[model samples]
Target chain A: MDNFEQFFTENRLKLDVEPLPEGFNNQMIANFRAVRRKKQTIRLFAAAGFLLLLVPGIMLLQPFFKPEPVALQESPSSAELSILTRLQPYQTEIESSTQFISQQRVPTEYSVQFQDFLIQLQIIDRQQDIYQKQIDSYGYTEDMIQQIMYNYELKLMVLQKLQTEILKINKLSKTTNHEYTNIQLEI
Target chain B: MLGNRQDAEDVLQDAMIQAYTNLKSLKSVESFGPWMKRIVINQCLHFIRGRLNFADLQLVNTPGESDETDYYQFSMEELNSTIQQLPDGCRIVFNLYLLENYSHKEVAEMLGISESTSKSQYQRARQLLQHQLKKKMNHG
Candidate 1:
């Protein structure tokens, strides 16, 4: 060991910890408490924020999230107007996507599935037209709006199912055509 | 390793707070001293990481006397104050290696420096400390 190392080792016990500043203990305690309190306040705020979001989210989605349909007897209300306003976009979306489907070429003849999709679409369309006439006559009762939204949603679902089937058939047709090309090349 | 007195005290207090909160995770009470030291040292290392530039410590010459009594006359407080006055890089390397008994490898890994750099800084520390002590001795 060097002279300094030797010196330090010899004086190790005599080497004092730095003399504490004035009121060091009191300062430590106060700072510790402040830090802990700050942490708890932050945690409380986080939980409060989460609950604040959750309650309104549940309220706004409550109607759509209902497992069983509510009986359509409520009088026309602002809430119904808001729901109808929100649903207007969905109505446009369904109509446009439905139109887009006719523009797409049918990749295969899934006769039974295609027939079922057509039948369901026709029935929902007929029901929606009836609801529209009733709303026109009665000035949009809550029940009429709900029925119209329900018909639109059902039609969108059937169209989505038919579109998925068509996509699957398209993929199968592409793979089969590739195999046929390989066979022709070999021959 | 933070040169400022108040900053060092603040780091020490934060380390204490960390140790107090995580005390339950300690496996044994006997190991508390080293564990607490680890916390404080970690806090200090974190504080100095942004400040210490390892590239600046070019060791000029080796330090030490053949006689083991060269610094025997100096008080521990005097030695400590001199150490405190050291440049941030070597002071930290010295504290970790000599005082804390960390291996050169461990010191390097802890300080995010190469082992050779750790050794060079340490040698620089020794040279600087010896220079200061020699000045003190001549004055006294």
Candidate 2:
């Protein structure tokens, strides 16, 4: 190299690479964590809000979920009431699982498909309720109790299937749009 | 270019944050070093542009400046201090073109100035540095 180039090269070599300011890396990591926490808080509030809207709607629609008491001549036995109480936990699980599935971010094309899946789950829930009402009316026979439990399992399975489908779609989208990989890394 | 260590640090921090946020958009990991340097340079330019009006960069005329022989007489420390004293526009063009090995065209594109402007700024920087170095040598 000529003296002009050599002069610059010597100067460049002499220039020191400055050390990062004290606590800078820690500060940066903290900022990133704070941003991530804010996003999680927002998501939590949204999920809570959705549950708030859903619970009251379900309560208002209680009549549709039950057969009229006048239709049954005999009062339900303790055994039938116990069966109803046992099913409550499964019902709560299904509701929360459905909520989780609906909260996922999906493409526009899959939204209609997701809606269809939800409708199918609702149909299954109504079927379970119908079988539950039959147990109250005809007395809790072994066969009737088994049918109700079967429908409960079916609802849970459908919810699990929907969750799996949502996860698959999320993975596919992340692969296609490379920027989404950063979000996944943050999570 | 930023003239002080504090301003340089601040710009570095901001550039690092931006780079981390957009890291996933980078296609190859091998390009990370150059990518980050570009981000830092851009941040420094942005900070300078925001604080200093371009129209205020007074064009200096230093006719009969000392020849290249004066630069050979000075120590590296003297050369460095003289570079640090250059005006912002001249300093930036000098650093990018000479030290950083960026072509005038690339420096112009990076700084959003015309190619001719980059060349003139570089020439002006060299002239000023040569003059300052000669003065220091004569005094010392």
lDDT of 1 at A83: 63
lDDT of 1 by residue, A118-171 (tens): 788888888878876765555555566667777788888988887787667656
Q: What are the interface RMSDs of all the models?
A: 4.2, 4.3
The Cα local distance difference test for each model comes to 0.72, 0.72
- Model 2 preserves the real interface contacts to a fraction of 0.27
DockQ of each: 0.16, 0.15
In terms of DockQ, which candidate is strongest?
1
Task: Kindly list the per-residue Cα lDDT of model 2 for residues A46-84, writing each as its tens digit.
Answer: 999999999999999976775334223465565556766
Query: Candidate 1 chain B — worst ten consecutive residues by lDDT sum?
Result: B60-69
User: What tens-digit string does per-residue lDDT give for candidate 1 at B1-140?
Assistant: 57687998899888887777875566764565577679889988987788778665554456544544466577777877898899888888888888778899999899888888888888888878877878888888
Which lDDT tens digits does candidate 2 get at residues B38-114? 87888888888776556524444545443556355666666777788998788888899988789989988987788
Q: Which numbered prediction scores highest in TM-score against the true structure?
A: 2
